[model samples]
Target: MRSVVGGVLSVVVVVAVVACSSPREPLPGLTASATVTTAQTPTPSPTIDYSDAELGIVFEDDQSLTGDEAEVYHWVATLETEYWRTLTTNTVSPKLSSIASPEIHVRMQQMADKNASIEGGHIGGVFRVQVRDVVVEGESARAVACLDYAGATFSDPNGSYTPEEAGFGGISRQELTLARVADKTWIVLTRTAAGEC
Candidate 1:
């Protein structure tokens, strides 16, 4: 990503549209009406061989946090990092379903579809997540964290996009909603912009 800000147009293009998913059914706490099911939510199957599935986004665990709090942070970072990777590479990840709910996945896939024509872009900077707090009741959880996307970047040969043009800036704070799936695996059900850190 040459324009880490607007200079990194690919990252800006991807991150610019990062928080743009509106689900058909309201997820747990949200009062908004979600999207329609006619939307084909793609699922990753083990049988589908992936030649370029893993983008190798790194998310480190915070030693200061533990238990469900830390795990939630991990999932948030994982999903966000993977999403960024997906956008930069312009490919859907095999682990998407494992970390993101179908609602989130659909949005990511849509961007990937748009990115199919774009060539040679990459994700830069770190997906640093700081857990502020987490409230878990039963199988559902809500979390607040700061995601440092200030240094993030994505770029293509033509410089087709820019942060200013894309309109995504400072993903410094976030509110994440999660639900428990099979095992303790938590997926990002929904997330919204929570101002800045």
Candidate 2:
């Protein structure tokens, strides 16, 4: 009987000690440490401006025109009207007009016509260019552009298709040399098609 009482008392004491030693639960707002959860808002995307003269050509968004239809037209127009016009008016040599045994006006018109069929429609792709090298001499500067052309469609709306029809379609990798005509104004004097430069 004494042994049983001692055993019972020992078990009671052990249970009390353990219960007292256990860590107490934290009060409502009081905690040992804090886990601060942060709520982050995304930053808005920037709007690209292509009309800045200082950012001309170089400021073009090379990726936006890919999936957007209207953007593609605007992109092509910027290249043909803004960039190509500068080249034809300021840097194109008279010799190039004779290279095809044709007048420069005729060749340019032909090019414009071919470009017309590709732009402003869903049958083509857009491209972006990066200026890789530039050599400035006197009033002229030769600049090279590394182009990335994609989503190009070579077929005409009239059911005619020609990938070889002089800038018709397909991503043709080449280097174009442009010269500076006026202060901060440059133009492409020569362009070698399919010539990787």
Candidate 3:
């Protein structure tokens, strides 16, 4: 899956997510901030068209990446992509359990609860994800990733959420702890903010 197509990082995947993650207060819950927020009932904005974003997820192709490191990068990218779909679909995706911990799964559910009352707008952009480092020790693994959300906008009833606005920001760095379950698949144990990268 790490095969470079055409160039070092030109293989952009425009994933058409059918059902995805949660988005209510902001991306902090599922994003790099990684802190679960209490559900808030925001004033409902009247909008007919539901907002959706065209996902342009491009991962850095490094031939040196193999084994555990490659697996970590792949799963983390999948998790991010699925989480962003929450903004477009506005429903907490149930698929997270397969890739994330139980706590992270609940956090996403909280986000969807918030999305219930917000207005929608189609936010267009690409979410750039790059793995910074990976460490493996027995059945435990940790991966650090830098996400560029400069091109993305959160779901705002008022229309658009500026990068500096309430819901989210530009670029963020996250450190995730993963555990190898009985199935031999890596499940994300924790995802915490690691400041700007």
Tell me the tens digit of each residue's lDDT in model 1 across 40-62: 77763322111122443334334
TM-score of each: 0.57, 0.37, 0.64
Better of 1 and 2 by TM-score: 1
- Cα lDDT tens digits, model 3, 11-127, are 232222323435456555465545778989985553222122445565553425556766666677667776776644667676787899889888877776667556554544666
Best by TM-score: 3
Per-residue error (Å), model 1, residue 127: 4.2
TM-score of candidate 1 versus the correct structure, residues matched by position: 0.57
* Candidate numbers sorted by TM-score from highest down: 3, 1, 2
- Looking at candidate 2, the ten consecutive residues that score lowest on lDDT are 64-73
Error (Å) of candidate 3 at residue 34 is: 64
Candidate ranking under lDDT, highest first, comes to 3, 1, 2
Cα RMSD for candidates in order: 33.2, 17.2, 30.6
